[model samples]
Target: MSTGAAADGGVHDFGCRGGDPAASAVSGRVSGTGEGKVRSLAWNQGTTLLRAWRAGVLPRRKKLLMTNTNAPSSAASLGLLVLRVVVGAIFAAHGAQKIFEYTIPGTIGSFADMGVPLAEIAAPVVAFVELIGGILLILGLLTRPVGIVLAIDMAVALILVHLPAGLWVGDGGYEFVAVLGVAALALALTGAGRFSVDGAVLRGRAPAWLS
Candidate 1:
């Protein structure tokens, strides 16, 4: 015969199947209560504490929808993954227009109208940077350099053309362009993610150099 405590804290008797008295005794103490207690802890504090810890130690993990041992964190990577394709397609299309529909001088004239200096030279340079930089950004190759150039290009556009327009794009204002310029700068800083060519190239490299 074996004697034990039941779930409600009462005594229970088993007729001689007592393989191990110690194990049976422990199992009785909190078999049901232990699980209930655990549930209570989770409700009261465990889950929240776990979430807070994750927030503090690895904030980047919060943003990652997928996981890999190797990943990129900088804006350049995020921009490439998030903004590259859209920006690239638009830029390439515009470049095609400059190369085909509009002559360099014509584009330069437009820039001059927008108050850009050295419109003749700046026109072709801007077109090429957009055309090429867009492609590079989308490809996740040389993302930092490409993002920097694109950010600069947008900055110049904002200063020369949009600033005078005011805030609303509907009002021919600089507001929309200014927002885009800031986003571009953010991309320039972060670089492409782990899936990018930049990440592949920088793999096994020192983090200091990359930062």
Candidate 2:
């Protein structure tokens, strides 16, 4: 079984598949920052730590060899899968409401009322971005770019519609949009996990970056 940690200092994973991964983890003693505390993740084993093996590095398992992480970390992939589905669902629903319920013209009217410049352009752009980008995010296709776009969309909404009310959602404040924006931004930075289409195609290959 693989393991992962949340943003908190504590580690989390699927409970008890067969063996005691926790015991093995303790024996290994949380090498480097995988101990948690949410720092920058190294794409591969630190070169400094692997210096001795540089001359004759032997291949391990196929997936492990392909991915950035040095060890199996299925739990983190699962966490990312969960995040993508939930956030994408919310985005898709809102997009559907704007497209079907409000209709493009009605959405344009709303945008005009809100004093958004170029409502004719902004309305459809926002609508399709939410709908198409949400679907892409759910499928984990082109995840990094989609995440970045969605984050910008929400940022615009937060600044234009919600910020005046302050932080409380009850007051039609920025809290909700802020959360959505930050979540999308996080995905942009991290990319979808190994369960994604990006992972399948890219396979952590020649370019160390770009999900």
Candidate 3:
């Protein structure tokens, strides 16, 4: 007798003794005696599968899934909130120094000494913009507009006072102002994120333009 196995591990015995050839081929086993056909249909099927795989007729498949962690997750929103508060605080402190510690007149004199144009008008306006804009940024109220204004203010500072000094803040260069401007521009583009007044009020209903 001969034996064969199916792909599922089932075995069939083909007794090669005293059996009708037609019956053995159709029933996959011998009749009237233990003898059966020389080959099993299961073995042929398995070989066909292997040949197909080898020939690339039945290639294996792989599955993949992708996710964007930076696209406004909860943690990302928290980070944005932290950035807003820190940058806002720094701006507010600078504004306070100019408006109170130095006094508006003294700040204007200082700007004029630095060769800043329209020192009298620009000094007071920059002071108030920094103070009020910083507060709004920290609170995440009207964040986009406030951020845009603050960015513009930093750009003016860079052009008027810091550009000529080069990149180092210690040498009165534009590096610090440039960084602040970039941060403000980021806020304007990304909005205040989830932990903000806008987020709370909108409750996931915010339009694309707003957040």
Candidate 4:
């Protein structure tokens, strides 16, 4: 005799009577028991296989499905986190030096000498963008908008300042500024990841404009 319990707490037993191995009878029923108790009892022997699959006892197929579904998002999140920190630190240091005279021009007059066009206007503006954008980028707050502005700022530098020198860093060319512009543009296109303040705000509620 073989026995089992059903989900609704009913008990079932299967047994053979007399000398017939093929001839089987259930005590309170027939070839089956449990009497409507086994709600998930699938109709065929193949049902056992299906149950095993639902329980994750089948590894090969499940693994393939999980891998294909989740891998790309994981990789992108990692890439975004890396880019955020590196870019932030680079901007912060450059801005600090300009703003505080820690390394370069103490004020607008020195910047004018460096041929930064209209230094009276451009110096403070550039310093504010670099300083404020760097801080926001590091905190991952308002990442998309900040990234957009920073990207534009870098693009302007590449066009107005660096392009005159050609392509090589040795030639004071567009190489560095162009690369920075692209990085900021990429961040603008994709918001910060789950580890960011921007992500927290996004999860709470959709921004008004997003609706």
Choose the strongest candidate by lDDT: 3
Instruction: Write down the lDDT that model 1 would get.
Output: 0.71
The regions of model 4 sitting more than 4 angstroms off are 1-72, 102-107, 204-211
lDDT of 3 by residue, 57-114 (tens): 6653211112253347898899989999999998888999999999999999999999
Please write out the lDDT profile of model 4 over residues 1-211, one tens digit for every residue: 6667868897644444543434533345542456454644555547888888888888878888897764337667778878988898778777787788733345577667657788778777888888888888877788788888889988887777778889997888988778877887778777776667776676457662221
Clashes of each: 10, 0, 6, 1
In order, candidate lDDTs are 0.71, 0.80, 0.83, 0.73
lDDT sort, best first: 3, 2, 4, 1
After superposing all C-alphas onto the true structure, candidate 3 shows an RMSD in angstroms of: 11.9
Residues 80-106 of candidate 2 have per-residue lDDT tens digits of 888988898889888988999999999
Residue ranges of candidate 2 with Cα displaced over 4 Å: 1-72, 204-209
Best by TM-score: 2
Least accurate 10 contiguous residues by lDDT in model 2: 36-45
Q: In candidate 2, how many Å is residue 1 off?
A: 63
Clashing pairs in 2: none
Lowest lDDT 10-mer window, candidate 4? Answer: 18-27
Error in Å for residue 138 of model 4 = 1.6
Q: What is the lDDT of candidate 4?
A: 0.73
TM-score of each: 0.58, 0.66, 0.64, 0.60
Candidate 1 runs further than 4 Å off: 1-80, 205-211
Give one digit per residue, the lDDT tens place, for model 1 in 5-67: 779797755433556666655666667689799899878797787788777744566546454
